[model samples]
Target: MDPTFLSAVQLAALVRGGKIGALELLDHFIGRAERLDSRINAIVVRDFDRARQRARALDNQADKSAPLFGVPATVKESFDVAGLPTTRGHAALKDATVRVSTLPVRRLEAAGAVIFGKTNVPVDLADWQSYNPVYGVTSNPWSTAHTPGGSSGGSAAALAAGLTGFEMGTDIGGSIRVPAHFCGVFGHKPSWGLLPNYGDPATSSAAGTDIACLGPMSRSAADLQAGLEILAGPDPDETALTLNLPAPRATALKGLRAAVWADQAGIAADPETTAAMLALADALEREGAIVSRSARPALDPLDAYHLYLKLLDAAWSGRLTEETLASRRRDLARLKDSDQSADAVMLRMTDVPHRLWLGLNEQRFRLRRAWTAFFREWDVLLCPAFATAALPHRQDGNTWERRITVGGREIAYNDLLFWPGLTGGYHLPATVAPIAATQAGLPLGVQIAGPIHGDRTTIGAAALIEQALGGFKPPPGW
Candidate 1:
């Protein structure tokens, strides 16, 4: 087997057993990536020589204290890696100076992980599919005709293609998990604020923002947990910072309570997707999990999602040119007759009064409380990762207006948000479990969510379910 195709855990075991040197493992992946990355366009920048040097250094020390010791991984282009161009997929940044590494990246490096290359992302990290003029588009390993979800698409695609063993990706809205789903890989969107978002090269000129988070995308759930353990916590110099997350109980799944809402009123899942989720539910029930088919973890997720969108818009609003703002003002004025004017939408959020923002936070608080209560009875919740399987690359400028077929029905492009928004809006922890392949051979995943701080249960349950239903299958061509 190719060393590059080994799971992070498996690779770690090899390193411990002296079956392969870390530098030798690095060479295996580097050689493969050099040859194959051109086809997928998953890697944006190459740091092969430097990565080899670091791998050799780690081999000299061979310390086992670091959880990720000697493991090779990639960072999304959006994250800074001091001295590497942090071109969040923008051509204008090609010649820009590299910024310092983010805390997440720093933690990974501190843990003895070799920082390889940066993966491609959509321009400005706004799109769900990774593509930009700088690095071209990243294709799904399963089918080049389809896309690996983005802006972490490159990371997901690279992992799926065996170009890299693991990667660090950012998730504000399905950026991490969606790509993982599309690529038939593993991803974890941690509880909001669990991982630091600092170290963005784009924010080098400005202070860091917190709406987004940095997480791990890998081939197995355990790797996500390992990365999270390395990256989760407050920054240094904080007078009082303590993070003590609990490990999952060793209890069997037979009696575990699970609330399932595979279908939602907001969006329709594809026939194959629906079937897959149902199959997973059945599997869990047979495994001793007390599946609750009646209860659905409900929130006005649409409204919460809208709020998240508004805040996200505000975060990026500063980058809007003056001319765009002027046009938006006119658009807002004309939208007076309608409730949702594009201009008013952007302007209203930018100028959201303290009271209004407070009210929004209160609503978010209430929703979190409701979920907290729901989790009290249910050990886990199962949902869809996206409305459809990986679709053909879309060039349309409006992701919201895009449409996809699900269950032989047409669904608005934004309908994908309904499922992702459910967990993201509350900053809860969720894992994507690959259960089956679509008729077209695309992978379909079910997003398993657990209460905030219940990251262990979410991942633990996924591991059990993955074992029950056969786990990852090697891509046909790979």
Candidate 2:
């Protein structure tokens, strides 16, 4: 096997068994980045000098039994790595230095992984395409003409192209899952608050943000599981509390209950994306897994989406600039009472009053109860991670003003937020795993979602699907 395509666990084992030196493994990836990164532009913030120092120290150490022993990895650019600028691709924050490493980074380091560099992200970490003023753009290894997916776009790209042994990324919307789907990797969008994020650009304080989660993204499902164990835990201050996430319910496809919602009525999900999902369902059924295409949560999809837009916006409302808030107010003023478009609802959520926010919270809890009931009968719900695969480089304007074609009809680009928001809004854990590719050869993945705190179940299902489907094929010429 190529050393570049080996899983983080495999790399660590090689180092511990003296088959490969820690520093040598780190340098192999560093050399690949130096020679090939211009094409994908994934690792935007280089810290190779410091990474080599750590790798050399690991090689010199006598005890090499750590979980991630000597594995080389990178995190999303928004994570705080002390002395590295935690810029989310904004030019203004180009010089703002991160004084402390984030909880995820510290934990990864504690597991004996060498943190090399930070990946690229969009400005404010808002868009799906990973392009911003600071890092330019990251192209998919599958197709440089298209995106790798964002705001964790570069994380997925680096993992897919074999530039890094592992990666950690955040997912509020589809940041982690979308990139995994586009790049044909495994990404786990953990249950909210399962992983503490201390140094994210938006949540620099001791407190973490709502609706957002810090999790792992990698080319292998086992790597995703290992990375999650390294990344998921308490904040430094929350050491008094014990962490006990649930274990996997099923490791094999037999006797597992899976509900799939690949395409919905009135929603313009691309047929190719849905077809990949259906194929996975068929494979699961063939393996004795109970697969259903009709099981759905009791809550309405549109209502969940509208509520999701508000709550999603509320999570980031505090970071909104006066200019941006003013733009939202202007957008709100032009909206009609019956206008429930994703853009309209999100714009209306700017500075939501406390009383109204409380009402929304009540509604969200009720919807969450309904989802819990639904998940009680199903082990996982597989769905389309995105309406389409890696989109063509679309950096023209902000997200709402953009449009995407689905099934020959044009729709609001943000409208595709249904799948991600529907589950993530209520804080369900979802793991994305590659199943097959489109006729055009673009990779396609299915989102395996389970109930809140069911991270293990989702990730386990992903591992089984990975085994059944021959996971994570490297893109041609990578």
lDDT of each: 0.79, 0.89
Least well predicted 10-residue stretch by lDDT in candidate 1: 337-346
The prediction achieving the highest lDDT against the true structure is 2
Assess candidate 1 and give its TM-score to the true structure. 0.93
Instruction: State the lDDT of candidate 1 residue by residue for 1-478, as single tens digits.
Output: 5676777877877776778888998888888888887788898788888999988887788456577778888989988888788878778888786667877888998977888999989888877889988888889889999889898999999898888877989887788889988999888888887876666545553344435667888888778878878888886734368798878743576887877777766456777777888887788888888887768555665566666656656656666788877866665565554544222344556445668767776777788888898888788888888877897898787564476676777766655666776787777898887888988899988898898988888888777767777666668887
lDDT tens per residue, model 2, 1-478: 4699888989999999999999999999999999999999999999999999999999999999998999999999999999889878889888878777887888999999999999999988898899998889899999999999999999999999999999999998899999999999989999888888886544386666789988999878898888888877777676867678888889789999999998988788788888878888888999999999999999888888889989998988878889988988888888898866688788888767899999998999999999999989999999999888889899878899997898787888888788899899999999999988888889999999999989999999999988888998988997
**What local lDDT score does residue 149 receive in model 1, on the 0 to 100 scale?**
84
Model 2 weakest lDDT span, ten residues long:
199-208
